[model samples]
Target chain A: MDRNIARLRNRLDGLGVSLRPHLKTAKSVEVARCVMNSPEGPAMVSTLKEAEQFAAAGVRDIIYAVGITPAKLARVAQLLEGGVDLAVILDTVEQARAVAEVSRQTGVRIPALIEIDCDGHRSGVRPTNQVQLVEIGQALAAGAELRGVLTHAGDSYRGGGAEALQHCAEVERLAVVDAARILQHAGLPCPVVSVGSTPTAHHATDLMGVTEVRAGVFVFFDLVMAGIGVCQVDDIALSVLATVIGHQREKGWIVTDGGWMALSRDRGTSKQTVDQGYGLVCDVNGTPYPDIIVADANQEHGILAARAGSNARLPDLAVGDRVRLLPNHACATAAQHGSYNVVRGSSHVVEAHWTRFGGW
Target chain B: MDRNIARLRNRLDGLGVSLRPHLKTAKSVEVARCVMNSPEGPAMVSTLKEAEQFAAAGVRDIIYAVGITPAKLARVAQLLEGGVDLAVILDTVEQARAVAEVSRQTGVRIPALIEIDCDGHRSGVRPTNQVQLVEIGQALAAGAELRGVLTHAGDSYRGGGAEALQHCAEVERLAVVDAARILQHAGLPCPVVSVGSTPTAHHATDLMGVTEVRAGVFVFFDLVMAGIGVCQVDDIALSVLATVIGHQREKGWIVTDGGWMALSRDRGTSKQTVDQGYGLVCDVNGTPYPDIIVADANQEHGILAARAGSNARLPDLAVGDRVRLLPNHACATAAQHGSYNVVRGSSHVVEAHWTRFGGW
Candidate 1:
């Protein structure tokens, strides 16, 4: 995790852009402290629950990255009034109007960013849709502080080589930068220009117009990121510790207590070139077993078997033997457990237990 | 939920078999109390966490339905010593030996059940493998109390008409009954004969020789169950309330705050005759929008769109408008939440808040 944090930190530092790590993946204050620029944070979160929890933990600068609803602005105002520089993201004029109304009503300057769509992956206004973008910006500037623009290269997870990732990074940069430029032209203050996704943050070659890069899953990279060439399999920092309960020797399956409840239902890698079924199976020491994966899972039982058509012999894992399953997606899998039993690379000695918070 | 409970209760009562409602779905004590045969339950659970939590709430009789490991026996022994009749299921002789060893050491007489594989869906010993079945039973009888046999027709989720479900139910029943007879032939006592799966429990035409039936997820019927003809769409008792935040009108997408984080990644209905994408989108009043579904989702965004190939027009849902999403799998979706805002049929007034417990 330290190495992953350092890798991105150094990369963004070289590009002359600050790294505002997204805390949605690791909802631990301890983890946030390690990745944040400071203890107070210039962090990003997906839910207000995260914003509130981090604010209570002394984090002041947070961007609630999801599109905001009018009903949620009261909580946002409360955080602002509590001395936290909490910002929200929105794409519509209706949302902008709501944010502005709440800001005026609460007598708190609510900061917000216009979400820009780069590749039409999910939410946000298209960069070329300058009319709606400016309208939304003008509405926010009326009462709320328009804090520039933001976009996520969500489509970057569709794997290509390094060239495609770099192209995606450039596309993401151009989207937010173009939106910020248009806002400036419309006599709106566009101060912050932000863009990211784990793949883009790692592969981005230039960030000339961007102020900060945001990413969450880099701290605990998973099979999805590895599949997209953003990281190696060994670079993944998260795994679910499981105990072998029994075996189906005739079917060549080893049953473990770690199932979807522990590993999550994210099949993020099924579309990748190599589909790590539910997860990749590893020894207790964090070494990957030969061609073994969680072939199927029930609510509480994971069936570990050799990958299809692989000749690798199933390991003689006895009942009560321990194994670690590397997840397909870090954020989804980590959300399953309450705490992380932190351990350093390859060594099983206990370090610390970091608590994780969840809910919206 | 009351209606769902009564339907199964009435069905099982007619079959003359006791109902051991699995608390794996609604991990709330209040919900458990509503569904259990009695306060001191003859209930089933998938995780020891549920067993421990329910036991703490005065649920005495619980069968940990997952195959047991030697390491978990200590916790089971603790529950048994606490005066809770905590039974565990296993298929292998190694697991049986481990349970027996733990029982002997703790002096708690841990009850054990031999799992029979009714269909080649997941774990359990095949009923025809009587030599191994008797071996496991005898191993349990050595120190642990060999209670009986259990089987789940997990493959019943693969949709067929009611006839197929009845056949699956019969297959599940005969497998456990045959295993119990094998154990009896070996001069071992087989007191309980258990069989279930939500579909099988509902469709079983005959339950002769079966002592008890267990089913979860029926408390909140999901799209998967409805697609399989087990229930109607209106019978679904669980739904995620979401607020519309934005829209991509050109793409006919209504964005909501509820994502996979709220709805879960269990696309259980995808393989059914009718696929309900992430979920079926409904109005605040619980009426589903014509052909509307959660087409795709990000971490905190659900994109609601018309079902593919449908001529249904997108509803003009403004920002802050509320909607409910009926899940694809009740168990998986409910696991994502910390609590349920209980409401009666078609009423928006939250009757009570039921806290849910999770972990293993």
Candidate 2:
């Protein structure tokens, strides 16, 4: 997992770019420390649990990556009281009004980022919604301080090729930039222009106006990232160490303990070209060995087999033998367990437990 | 959760079938009590954590679902010593030897279930591999007691419909029956012939030679089961209650506090006619709305909108308003959170903390 995170960081740094990594995917406190670099680096969090954990860990700056709920405002206000610099995000005028009202009541000047639609994939205001952004800006300005605009290039997870990813990055940059300008044009103080997603971060060169990038999956890259032309298969770090308990030689099936219970049921690879079955098949060293994929999985059993037509041999594998499996989706795979068994090469190293909070 | 657990038992009573429902999914002491109406109702568990906890809670009979790892054999042996009638599964000759040797060392007469390949989806000895099963059986008979043969119809999850699922179930039954017959022909007593899966259990009309069934997903039915016509959407009980956090008017997106963190990244709906995004959109009271689906999701955010061309006039939902989301896969979604925030209508009833177990 460390290698993948470093590889993405190095790749982006070589292009004179910085990544505002989301700590939500790898919720490990140890990993977050590495990402934040001791002091609070600019990071995106999916929940207040993550924000509170990172903030309490002495990280000063954070962006609650998920859109903020009005009901959660009092909690966000509580977090602000801790003296940590935080930014909440939203897209609608209704959400802005709610945040503004909460800020007025609590006397908490929590900064807010307006989510802008880039790919029409999920949440956010449309790129051409100049009037709505102005309305939201005017509303939030009346109550809370307007931070800036943020957008996630979600579509970058689909298709293939760096050119496609690069195009997505350009579009993502335009969306956030356009939304920020609209807020500024409406007399709202908009400063930060944030865009994120692993592929966009890897391919983005003309981040001239992009202030910060908020990508997450690159930290513990999965098969989805590798298959989408974002990263090489070898770049994946996080893997479930499983033991081959049994096999049916008549029909190629290897049963391992790393089922959905261990690796999660994220079928992100199903849509990719070389559908990594349940997850990308790998050797004990985390290398993707061709033709070996987890074809099916149950709650606590993964059914692996050699792919349709390849000279992939399952000869060396036997009962009690161990193998590391690269996840199809990093976030899902990481969320399955309580902690990360942080390893170094083939050595059984330290185990870092991620204390997860609940009730969003 | 309690109500649904009872519903499963009642459904089984109606079918007049005895099953050893795996407690691995619902690793709760209280839930296990609800299911153990008969002697055979002693649920199978996948982890040693469950075995220890359940055994301590007075559960005598348990089949530790996963193959007994070397490190875990001692734990299983310990549980067996605590007056818990234990049975463990093994698929390979080497695995049988490991369990037998552990049993010999610990003097824990651990019962064994030799896994047979009912469907060539995951683990087990093929029906044609009579030689291997006979070898393992003879070896185990010399060291440990051979209880029976077991097979999980895992392929039933992807078999599509009743006909397809029935075919898969037949394969499971035949594989186990064939293996049992082979052992019987060798003058070995193979008492147990087990077949299981929610699809198989619900649709099986001929459990003629099968002694036991092992279905776990029935208690907390998910959208995946509903997608394949095994269960109706109304049968689902658990849902992730989320508040509308943000919105986009033009793109028609309502952002929710519950993302994949709460809902899980199980996209079993992708193969269906309408991909139910992250989950099936439900009202605040746990009723699925017509054509309302979560279109897309990130780590901690979900986008709720219409399923397809059918325009849905989503309720006047504002930020802070709560909505329940029925998940695509129950086990996956339930695993996302630490515990279930059980509710009865609008009142908060109880919090059933799932005691999860990891490692061998």
Candidate 3:
């Protein structure tokens, strides 16, 4: 955990950019503390529920990264009133006006960031859609301060290698930075230019115009990250501890107590070169078990077999034996459990339990 | 909820089999009360945690359907000693001996069910493996009571149609009943003969030898069940309420706050006749929006789009507009939420709030 935090922090520092590590993955206060370079530094959260938890934990600066809805404004007011330096995102003029109206009604200055779509992957206003961008900026400026613009290069996940990742990183940087320039040209206070996704953040060649980068999955890299070449298989910090309960010897299946309920139903690696079935199985101490994959999962049972179509001899594991399964996506898997059974260093003993906050 | 309960109860009553409704779906005490045919009737649970919750709700007869491990015997003893008529399943002689040892040590008469693998879908000993089955029965009878055998037609999920489902159901019934016969012939008490899986239980032609039918996911039918022709789409009782947060108009994507976190990472319909993406999109009144689906999902954002490769028009949904998404698998989707914001009849008004217990 410490190494991952340091790796990202040092990289961003060298690039002369701030690290606003996304808190969505590790929703624990302890993890947030480790993620932030300083004790009381800014961090980004994906939900208001996270904003509430992180704010209460004394980490004041927060960015509710998802586009805000009017119904959530009242909750935003509570956070602001509690002295939380909260910033919200919005792309539509309707959302901007609503945020502004809520800010006006509550007499609280809600900081807003214009969400720019770098890639046609998910939600955001196109960076080049200057008319809509300026309109949104103007509307938000009425009752909310225009913090800047931000874009997540979601397509970066589809990238094959470091070359693709670097290209995506550049695209994300250019789009957010260009949006900031347009807003600045319109006389809007464009202070922050944020762009990230684990792939892009780790591979970006430059961050000259970009003020800060935001990423969540880099904290506990998973198979998806490994498949994308952002991290190696050894860097994955989270894994589901499971117990072998049964076997289908003919089919070479080892049934484990850990299923989708323990590991998540995120088939993130399915699109990659290696379609890790459910997850990659490992020994209790986190050593990768050769030729084993959690091929399928029921509500309470995981079918561990040789990765699809492989004729690898099934290990002679018996019932009551323990193993671990590394997740395809750390964010999704971490959300399954209420807390992290933390293990530091090479020890198998749980060092401390870190509580993770969930829900909206 | 009452209608779903009645539907299953009526079906089981005519089949002359008891209903051991699996509480893994609606883990609520309130739902369990409604689901139980009698106030103190038997129920099935996937985890010891659910067994603990249901037992505390005054539902006496509970079966922990998963194969038991030595580690869980202590918790099982607690449930049994607390006057909960708890029964556990085991396929191996090792597990049976462990249960017997625990029962003997605690002076708690643990009831045991031998799991028969009728279909090679998941865990259980084959019914034809008479030597092992008899050994397990003998081991359990030493310090525990052999309550009979149970089998889940897990492969019924992979069956093609009604013909296939009926065949799988028959396979489940015969394997469990044959196991019981073998045990009875071996001079071991074989009483309860359990067989089910939502697909199998609903399609079974003969329940003559079966004592009880255990099925979850039937109460809240999903797209997978609908695709298999087990239930109509209207039979689906659970849906995710989501709010339109933004849109990528050019791509025809309507972004919402319902993400994989709200909808779950269960892409269960991917292999169905109609791959419903993440889920089939619906209006607030539970009306299906033609051709629309939650095409993709991030942690807190669902990308609402036309089903893959379909040039369906993006609906004119603005920010804050509400919609509902019918899940691919109710069991997997329902696990994502902390509680059910239950609505009764045709009204949009929340009639009740039921809490669901999650975790192992």
Candidate 4:
């Protein structure tokens, strides 16, 4: 196995659990097949588009990881009926009620994983909100089945250091186990207590109550993850393959075809220790040459230059020369391109097209 | 005309020039038909997918406005041969020579538009690079028809005020006319000197050398333009109609289905005076309130709250209620969805569905 993959696997196994990696970041089925089928029973996804792709590629047991939109319930139910054990995550009783109503009407018998708010802010019900469990469980019992509870330590990225990872794990365990206990005491079956985030899943000392651990981005880590001390730059697998289109020799700038349009306009790691201006510029094989952080990006053109912390000097880059850029965030960067130009050791081997679905 | 349409049209007409709006932003055949059949000739497209769509919709004149990629040359050539007056833009002499070679070998004349870098340090040949110009013109003369010089006052967007508009016009006039004059005086009969951008074309002071205009965002003005003083907030035509899905009452957050995945992660106006966070949150009819700018966005969720600039007092916004979001950049935002739910007048009725195209 690749050292990065082996490192991630060993880390996950040390917690006495298996990693059911999330496929949201790597939207490619070819990539997901590599992750999910690797000693992991199931995986998680942010969109039904991912679900459809992964299912088409023969991954059966999966979880629609994000909060479900009511409009997509029918399609999700269809996926469930197609013998692919699909479970949805919802934080609110209303959403659970909607799912239950649809399930009862169609006799779909779909299972749901109630979402727990590890943090106070984003989506998901607070684990401290004990009454929500009884209420939501009763609502689900009327129409759907309550599988257990799921929580995402999303703010884990904010806690970038090893200490931050431990902090995130503490929050995750408390939230997931607390929510599970609430559901269990409510006379409902809470079998699976799932919690995820690359940092927490990688560093958590115990996975006592957690049945399934969901983590993505470990396969292809990013600058944001590296900045947070979660993974080193070497773990990142993907890069934007771009040609040096032009240059501003006077400004010591190298121009490339990879712009904000190619790398995405996400300043995901900007507030962190290392702000990868656009992204960390590298050779075609993903080796980082310090000087080239694509500094300023317009629509179709990226300006490559040396930022303040850069130690390297790009001595040989010229127009028409090719390079790759390791993105700050994988999901956001991957979403910018319509297809993944998947490379197996540098030859243009295969392309995994992503059909991004969007609607009300 | 509706207030939105009239406001946009009046601005373009006021400038004494018409806009060749990009179907890439609007993506509606009916709207393209209306704009083309109106006073403005066909249009420009940001992508070949859009160019193909418009060509099939009976549009005669079209510019595959972005820099031509080598992989797409065959398709562009095919479109030209299919009787579509597809004018493609090229910046480098290398690009011109390559395209010219393609045109020469195929025995089909593809109208080539030379791109002029008018202060936007992205793509395009520097207007002052004359030795390169003669070589490119000679190459075009050898095979491809040197139709004209094209300059996008792309920087005009950054210059949203009156002075900025004037700056746009000056640059447009100088870059296009000067480049065209250079080729013409060198004995290459370059007739057209095309120039445009919403900021410049909508505020054109003179057209001494410009033959035609290519301004796309004018047809569907965005929050960035609105923030820049080019267009009023009410002039923004298209918006993402999003249904509120969940809420974190304590945090005063209203979650919506229109996530970054739907809106795209292009924070086009984040560096502007009024950073419309994600986008400008508006009512169904396009009227923006001070309460919302879709404060934060994730892949499957858009957190609607008080505008970052305004007081954090959100309205009685609840779950399941729908709201509209005016985009940061019309092009990037429109690229996220498959089609538009085009509304006529102030009515919520779907007058027509605009089919969109994707891929490079």
Residues B1-360, candidate 4: write the lDDT tens digits: 245456556765765655666666667677676666352346888667777777787777888876665556799988888888898877767667778888888888888888888885566777898987778888888888998888887777776579768877887889988999899889997877888777777677778767777766777888788877877777777788887778888877888877887787878787787788898777777677675778888777898888655675766665556788888887778767778777876689997776766655
lDDT of each: 0.92, 0.78, 0.89, 0.77
TM-score of each: 0.99, 0.91, 0.98, 0.89
Q: lDDT by residue for model 1 over A1-360, one digit each (tens)?
A: 999999999998889999999999999999999999999999999999999999999999999999999989999999999999999999999899989998889889799999999998889999999999999999998899998899999999896989999999999999988998999998999999999899999999999899999999999999999998899999999999999987878799988998999998899998888889999999998899988999988888899999988988899889889999999999999988888888989889879999998999
**Tens-digit lDDT track of model 4 for A75-157:** 88898888888998887888888999899888898799888888764788888888987798888878798999988888887
> Considering only N, C-alpha and C atoms within 3 Å, which residue pairs clash in candidate 3?
none
* Candidate achieving higher lDDT, 3 or 4: 3
Question: What does candidate 3's lDDT look like per residue over B22-76, in tens digits?
Answer: 9899888988888887666589999888998888778899999888888888899
- Model 3 lDDT tens row, A211-253: 8899999999999999988998888999898888887887788
Q: By DockQ, highest first, what's the ranking?
A: 1, 3, 2, 4
Cα distance off (Å), candidate 2, residue A27: 0.7
Q: Higher-TM-score candidate among 2 and 3?
A: 3
Best model number under lDDT: 1
Clashes of 2: 1
Q: Chain B TM-score of all predictions, in order? A: 0.99, 0.92, 0.98, 0.92
**Candidate 3 chain B weakest ten by summed lDDT:** B1-10
Stretches of candidate 4 off by over 4 Å are A1-7, A37-41, A52-60, A69-84, A308-319, A351-360, B1-19, B27-31, B37-42, B47-60, B67-82, B96-110, B125-144, B284-286
TM-score of 4: 0.89
Worst 10-residue lDDT window for candidate 1 chain B reads B266-275
Clashing pairs in 4: A160-A228
Error of 2 at A19 (Å): 4.4
